[model samples]
Structure formats: C-alpha cells, structure tokens
Target: MVGLRVLTCGFAAAALSVAGCSATGTTGTTPSGRQATTSNPAPGSPSTASPADLARKQASAAYVGMWRDVAEAAKTSDWRSPILSRHATGDALSVISRSMYADHRNGLVAKGAPKTYPKAISADPSAGPTTVMISDCGDSTNWLKYRKDTGELADDTPGGRRAITAEVKKAAGGWKVARFAVEAVGSC
Candidate 1:
C-alpha cells in the first residue's frame, strides 16, 4: 500500500504538471533565441513552424531546462520554491513538479552519486501538439544521507543511477512539465 501510494503520488504529480501546460494553452520561452523552423514555405518567405512542431520545441526546451535545474534543487529540499516564486503556472509547474518527484526518488538512495557523476538527458524535438513533450532518459551519480542509531549523521555512498523520462508542454508563460517517469538503474 505504501508503495502504491508512492507510485500514485508520483503519477499524480506528473499529471498535474502536464495539466498546467495543457490548460493555459501556452508555451514557455524567452523571446530572445530563435528556433529553426521545420518546413520551408517559399524561397523568399520566412520559414514558419507548424503548430505541432512548435509544441514539441516548447516541451523539449521546458523539460530539458528543468532537468538541468533538478540536480541543483536536490541540494536543497525546497528546489521547487524558486520555480513557484517565478509564477510558473502551467508548463513550468509541471516540469518542476515532475522533477521534484524524480529527485525524491534519488534522495531515497543511501550513498551519494559517484565521484564522477554521469549526467545526460536527451530531447527528441520530433514529437507531439502545439506543445512538445520530450523524454529525458539518463543516469547520474547520487548520494543519500541518513541517520543511524548512533545519533550521528551517516551517509550512504551508493552510486545510484537513474533512467528518467519527462514530458514538457508550451504555456503562455513558457514551457512546463506534462509528465515525468523515472526508474533507478543498476545496483546502488
């Protein structure tokens, strides 16, 4: 039952994150960088993005960007605080929420990430709607801290690895999370 609850909570968190982006009908992005357009329209015309392509880009950017932040946030239990303060409603909230879920799983580990942490997340810009949802599958070195009966702080040196997937969406504010799933890889 406890395991079910944990899984349910994780999925619920993913769903909520996705909903934020879907509800607002927005995509998150700074107006500065220009993304490459897919289909070429005319010789002299500016190439424009199809709704589908735009969605994928939005989700990919949001999801990938969030993953980068997750590692940093794990250092502080309140990683989502900065995201919330930014008023990250739709896609942004989804991304962060999903990341928090993933991070929590890592926190359960005993040992920390390997000294040479392997971190990598992939974004496939070739999938989904007016907002794209990318999958981030990768591994990392993580550390887990716990207290023993001795009343002193003890740390587990498990080099936990992970395979994580995230779905992002486009929101009015920017990109946000649509879904997130993660599985610990190998032995700790």
Candidate 2:
C-alpha cells in the first residue's frame, strides 16, 4: 500500500506565474512577507496573493520538476544524481531515493512515466513566509510503471493522480524542498 501510494507518475510541475500577480523577487520571496506584492505597477489597481498560497505553489512546482528528473533517472538505474541535491533535501529525498534504489534492485521500473498537472494548491496561513506548510493536489493519471527486463506491467495505480503536502523553506539562493508526503489519490 505504501509503495503504491509513493510511486506514481501522474503529477505535473513547473514554475509560477499568475495572470494579474506580478513576481516581486527572483526566489519567490517578497520583502514584506505579509502579502503577495505584485510588480504590476498599473495606475488603477494591482493583484495580491496570500503569501501561503504563493509559497505552496512555488514549492509544489519545484517538487514536480524534481520528481520528473527522478523518474528519468530510473530508466538508467541512476538514483544518485545532482538534481536531487538541487531541488530537495531531508526525508523527501530519502523516501523517493530509497524507493527508486529498491525498485531497480527488484527489476521493477516505471513504464510510461509521470504526467502531472496542478489541480489544487494551498498553504497554512498561520505559517510564516520563509517557512510554509503546503498541500498540493494534481492529476498524475498518465503515470504508470512496468518491469524493465521482462516487459511486464508493474503498477497502474487506480485513478492515476497524486496528492502531496510539503514544507518549503526559503534558502539564501532560492526555495528548496525540505520534505514532502506522496500518496496515490482517487482523482485529480
């Protein structure tokens, strides 16, 4: 049950850009930290985002990118790569990294790969800007796995979606994934 929940390809990840909300800083951090300040200096009005929402979206996008890379690495049985170091740290890395290693040893690998799209995003309002607890939901239905040598299907998780809750922390350079919880969801 745990393995099935953890390993799924149906997740989407990318960068952040809202139609009205302009980005203030390079690392997804706003100086004020009270609200999402916009770079849109229009005469009439501007958009504002809750700091927690912004933080979660940014971190979730980063996680999807990192997980995608991790999937690609599985094709060649390469688990230890620099991408892991760049995007994530702590238990998040530990869980996925170890899982991939075991999968390789067991001769089971993902088949089609993970395809993710953001479904919902939210963050804890009580948390500060630098550190926010984020829960992200997405559709990963296209993600499936199979055996490497025998050409047999390994897992085709029901519904094909993934939901993750993560803690994203702002470092000196940019946002890094502190950790995350991955689970196979019923729907996107």
Candidate 3:
C-alpha cells in the first residue's frame, strides 16, 4: 500500500511536469549550453521544423500523453488499458501498470489530472536526435487516490509540486516515454 501511494502520487507529479515542459514552448538550454527551443511550424507552412525541434516536440507530447493515459486508467484502476502502451514503453509502462494493478487490488482509484510543465533539457546528437531528456516541475495538487467503495480519500498525504525527469526515445511507432522518475512532494 505504501508503494502504491508512491506510484500513484509520483506518476501524477511526473505527468504534470511533462505537460508543463511541452506546453509552455519555452526555450531550454542543453547540456552543452546550446540554446534549444521547442516550437512548431506556424499554420500549414512548409514545415520548417528542424529534426531536433521535431524530436523535442514529439518527445514532450509523448511524455505528457503518458500521464493522460495513466490518469484515465487510474480512474477505474484498470492496469490493462490499451491506451497505456500508446505513449509509454519499457519501465515507464511497467511502473504505471503495476501501480494500477495494485490500486485495483486495494480498491482504490485516482481522480483528477496532474499538471505538467516539461522542457526538453537535452537531445542526443544535435542533428537528427533519437532521444530526448525532459525536466519538469509537476503539480499533483488536485490528483489523488480515493477508495472506490466509499468514495473517500485513501491516503493522508496531499499531492503537491515535485521534480520529475524523463527519457523519451524514438520507437518503431513513435516517440515514447522510456522511463521517468518522480521526486517526493515539494521537491520542485
């Protein structure tokens, strides 16, 4: 049960972080001090987005999407939701599944969605990147677990802001969150 709380709360923080990172369109500095920007082509222009830019955008989207999928599954404690695989893979997927399974067994369900602010911190290879590192300050203030049978809060700990990091890799389908780590509450 303690592990389940950590997983549920931790994932909410991670999701918030990823969403914030991707949605702000803020410029980030890479490990080498290079200025990296995440922006998309205006309208339907010639699509002048660089490979690095595209990778960052896609990776950020996947990270944010993973959180959304997890939130959806958490509502019903459904670990086997097919949507989980759409944006997550590897350990990222495994952790979410395990968390949801535990929630199901314990008769707990999560409500609300997390808010993420994710930024592309780094990309492997300046040109034509295949992996992107994301840093985020996720807020899980409103996302929390509840007892399904009684509709009551399950944990005493309230969610809050936390720091999160994720590695998104290019997969056969598309960019996917390969792994992520969420710190304890107030970590941000």
Which candidate comes out best when scored by TM-score? 3
* Residue 184 error, candidate 3, Å: 1.0
Q: Please list the residue runs of candidate 3 whose C-alpha ends up more than 4 Å from where it truly belongs after superposition.
A: 1-5, 8-46
Cand. 2 TM to true fold: 0.63
TM-score for every candidate vs. truth? 0.45, 0.63, 0.77
Worst 10-residue lDDT window, candidate 2: 11-20
- RMSD values for the candidates in order, in angstroms, are 12.6, 10.1, 10.8
Q: How accurate locally is residue 142 in candidate 3, as Cα lDDT from 0 to 100?
A: 82
**lDDT (CA) for every model shown?**
0.39, 0.56, 0.77
State the lDDT of candidate 3 residue by residue for 38-146, as single tens digits.
8654532236556666677889889899888888888998999999999989888888888889889999998988888889877776588788888878888888889
Sort the candidates on TM-score, descending order: 3, 2, 1
Off by over 4 Å in 1: 1-49, 84-128, 142-161, 186-188
> Measured by TM-score, how close is model 1 to the native structure?
0.45
lDDT for 91 (candidate 2) = 64
